[model samples]
Target: MTGIAILPAGRDDAFEQYKQLIRDRHPIEDIGSYLNDEDLELFRTTSDDDLVHVWGTSVDGVWRNIERNDIALVYHDGAFVARGQVLQLRHDPDLAEYLWRKNVEHGRWNEEIPWEYMAFLTDIEEVNVDIEEFTELVGYDKTYRQQGFTRVADKRLNQLSGEESVKTVIADLTDAGEHIHPVGDEDDGPTPDLADQLQAASTDGNAHEEFEKLVAKVFSGLCCAADWIKREAYPSPSQPEAGGRPGLR
Candidate 1:
């Protein structure tokens, strides 16, 4: 399922980074200078266009579900200022260091937090979407404010779109010439107390087993072609295979 990613760029430094990396396109030849041979090759293969923009985040876990073709909404000030489609994603600290050097110069770079999770984007469009209207369409609270890199799950989008395609709903909402009908709040009501239910579920003896199954399910969806293997069969970097270096099978 295609998803939507909200990227917050309201902070002064973040906005500057956005202007440099996202608003303006960079030639692959120019960016290639900062990448290693392996990364350069990977970037070249994934990006068919000569010019592209890179968006990165230091936050963990938030980017795991994002995939190619996901819509990226760039939020700044009180509105969404830009939108684009993610073409490629990578986690390369070396490349990120070069791209966000201002963070380093400002002494904001830490070994623990690095802007390494990247999304290469194409077909970018400048947009003007007020937060209130956007939140209404997505079924979020009218006062909802994006705090960080956030993903609106496909399930949530599917619920909001009903029979219509999520992509069509997103396109219409973001299009300047289009009009959006506010989602009805007739079903909205007092929140239900799930404390007892959560406590019972958390105390289940098979919780760990259930978690393992859930992890496997998510990973299977992410990499359908990946081979399932036992932990013993996984190669360690220190122990290379007979003919080749250690790597996933």
Candidate 2:
């Protein structure tokens, strides 16, 4: 089963360092020449890595665990601003040139580093994963502090505090249901209507009554992680595949 993975974009305005490096690589004074000032500011300020080319030399193992088609979230400040699926993992210079050159020209990304490794993402979507809601559900575990890539097992997630509260927050958001899709996933199929989904889940003809079940269905992987833990408490006859995250492996 596919798992959700989190990655830190940067803390504070540290991504600014990367922006400045991009400027140094390619000399461009007028940032507005490529995009408006507001967009330029967003590119510099946001930690969303929709088409980000990262330095992946040391984190090869972590990247390996995050297989293609698994979901990835780019997190910064107190929420996740971007989400995508791993499309490809490669060390191709041509791919880097095509993806980064435009951004470099627009003063958005640093110049291409041919030797740097990268993970390509597709179907990138932007969403808010509120820290308060997240903390209430999972408590303050060391798992959140993980950098690079951290995969939280469903079983581990079940150990967090306030599972009901997390479900409530997810239900509330789903009720307001906004359509979210990545840039290139136009052909993926019709986006499900949140209200319709909730209604289908309702058995007693009450909207609120069905919400909890819908939330559980949506977050089944997270809510049921602990069931796997309960069944297999570790040191089994056969060791399962080691995943990302520090000590869990």
Candidate 3:
């Protein structure tokens, strides 16, 4: 099984309301089909078995490749803020009402797009994965910037399983509350600051040029040494230029 990282927004700062709905054990499904007893029951049910729901138009292919036991990682701001497993996935347009549209005024639905694939994520575990460690292990550098769920690479997935920090966080999954940690906070030590610094450095305009320059600087001495050895071993057939070695300008 693979893993996906998703970003959930709260109607532009209505996160508290969204949290309340999730805490109430609501399915977040559209209520248009209340005529169906099964749908109503699902809407009313409070037992999620630690599952969370994630959906988006961009996740159609992602959910297709995802299986029941595949991992789901959540990102907020710049952190890998939570983790869960896929319990089920479906494309139910009628259930779009179930989506939390806190940004919309009362009784309005978010019609930015039609209802798409939604994944029922269970076995939820919260974690605070630094972006650097996350990218290093997951092989995705800009996970937080992704709009929807992204498939985890197989090689990176194996590497993640062996990570002690990730294991420590995943092993402590006893409740939903455990999945949260402070982001960019000094109290959490220098991790957030370091992550921010790394992000800035990576996004800087001259990052690639600087990296190339650094590489050349580190190897220039070796090249010089090699040239000196060649010059000492053999004499030049022709005289050198006024200020440079033979065959060199």
Candidate 4:
């Protein structure tokens, strides 16, 4: 997969620094010059790498005063082969393992994130994950893509907070006769206790009525991440592997 590595008009050394840092974690100028008047907070490399590359997703407004926005590393292979949020990036082994499991994300992410992910971020603060740090950990966890889904499912087991909310939304949708992807053993395995808990929570009859409102809230981040990679703003710089590569997506 490919993405445009925005060159700040002419900062060649800065660009080399960008590539070298990604390749070697060497120190480089944190700032660089752009075309007249507009200095760049960062620089770009000569080309985008096939295996990995870091690119700006959205810039923060305040950083806009001096280039604010979140930028993150994107993965192409391994379990974490999914389009990810810079904020979501973490060094925790467990979370890293979880992310690696969802990398390809049902094979729907070979395409870049849609521009829509850019819609909700209000400022640069939202994009603050350190790209340099994130890139270093890209494929640290060695599992294959199947692990990503397993991790998400495993996460469900201990999700005291999100499950009730998910169950409420699911129950509401089920009641409304609204068609949604059925929560199957494939992803949401049968857990009688979880089901019982879900049933107890379903007492609120309006959950069905509030379905749309609920999806709007709970699906915001997930959908935004999906939207970002699906849009034109994130096209691969060159022709992508048709149907995408395996083991990742």
Candidate 5:
């Protein structure tokens, strides 16, 4: 089931950070400049224009439950100000430090635990839904105020039939029904062609090279780990089997 994560973008400093990171999208090149090779590669695999946001270790437990395609509702000043679909996640303190070091230097953020847990998001849109209406929709008390990052409890969403996800409920409340994609309904049109290509390649004389390419393609598609996969699959091009690698670069 697709989950919904409530991200409290508090007033003042926190809100300012939200505006800088989530509201105003950062250039990928700017972001890439700060990342180490490992994290930079991960960053590149996301949708070209996705927004990447982060949460500190305080919400690490809650963040773990947030999966790909989950709805992330940004709350601030008694309303959901924005929403987006999660595309990928990473836990890298170095990258986080680079992104939010300004806040730390200014004493706004805790230096002890940086916002290390990153979430790459797409389909982001500005929204405005009163807390009362939002709480009622999600089965929270009308007076409830979110204090931290959290996944809406399953019991609150129990009213939804098995096929329905949190995305459906939020869409209805915000009149964004047209933007909701059904849970688990990703477009897989290219999967068959990829499989066919892999099969044909496996029968070629260079079985080792074909095998490595197959692994790279599969991992790249599955987890957006194309760079990491290529690095491991072709660590040194000096090997005869690593010659003429295609489709990865």
Candidate 6:
């Protein structure tokens, strides 16, 4: 379980210093009993930002690997979208992350884990309002999130179009209740905020739930279409390995 702290952003010096602070170190130096070839190779190759590849036998028996990305996506409607927004529909940041990492069976920091192995943490978020739309409500009550790897093709994106939907959302939300706009006062738009949809949908009776369902359908369709890209780019072999890696030959 990871917790997010909204501290002020820092300089490159601070980031580098933070990296050094968490640099992996071996308790013992050059002792034959300390480690083995594969283990040392694992440590030497992986960095603070890179997900370590720990494959093969554990030497003690169990073998495993772990990696994480704040967001992943496939090409949908020609764009690259972050995963954080999808999760937001489920709840606030805390609740959203709770659901994303909820399914892991093993802890990354277990002492049993290799001391040389370092973990990586990343958060994928939209930079502007337009990008924010790539993220949306998960359900009527924010029950689930949707996000991942994507290749957004809209030309406006490749260019630095400074549109911020978040600002738009907050503006509309606040205007409706006089409290939400404080968050979105800068943007110029008459569009409805997310809360507006929730309220309007509530009044419309079924619109709230219907809207969320529509979101899921749209995302699923995009993902399904993107899968075909991978299939076309790299066709799968006919025979399959039941529980093992595919054979090259």
Against the reference, the lDDT scores of all candidates come to 0.67, 0.42, 0.44, 0.24, 0.64, 0.25
- Candidate 2 wrongly placed segments (more than 4 Å): 11-58, 93-115, 135-146, 157-249
Better-scoring candidate (TM-score), 2 or 5: 5
- In the range 85-194, model 2's lDDT, one tens digit per residue, is 55545655554454355433332334432323555444455567665555555455634543545654656444641323222233243232112211112222223674
On lDDT, the candidate that comes out on top is 1
Please report the TM-score between candidate 5 and the true structure: 0.63
Model 2 / residue 249 / CA error / Å? 33
User: Against the hidden reference, what TM-scores do the models get?
Assistant: 0.63, 0.40, 0.47, 0.19, 0.63, 0.17
Off by over 4 Å in 4: 1-125, 140-188, 192-196, 204-249
Q: What CA RMSD would candidate 3 show?
A: 23.0
Residue 229 in model 5: lDDT: 18
Model 4: weakest 10-residue lDDT segment is 117-126
Residue pairs in candidate 5 whose N, alpha carbon or C atoms collide under 3 angstroms: none
lDDT winner, 1 or 4? 1
User: Model 5's lDDT to the true fold?
Assistant: 0.64
Deviation of model 2 at 21, angstroms = 15
Q: What ranges in model 3 sit over 4 Å off?
A: 5-24, 27-58, 101-112, 142-145, 159-249
lDDT of 3 by residue, 115-192 (tens): 356665554555676556656545666543545556666666566655232323343432232221212222222332
Q: Give the TM-score of candidate 4.
A: 0.19
Instruction: Please write out the lDDT profile of model 6 over residues 175-241, one tens digit for every residue.
Output: 2111111112222222346456545654554243334333333334344211001010222244422
Say which prediction, candidate 2 or candidate 3, comes out ahead on lDDT: 3
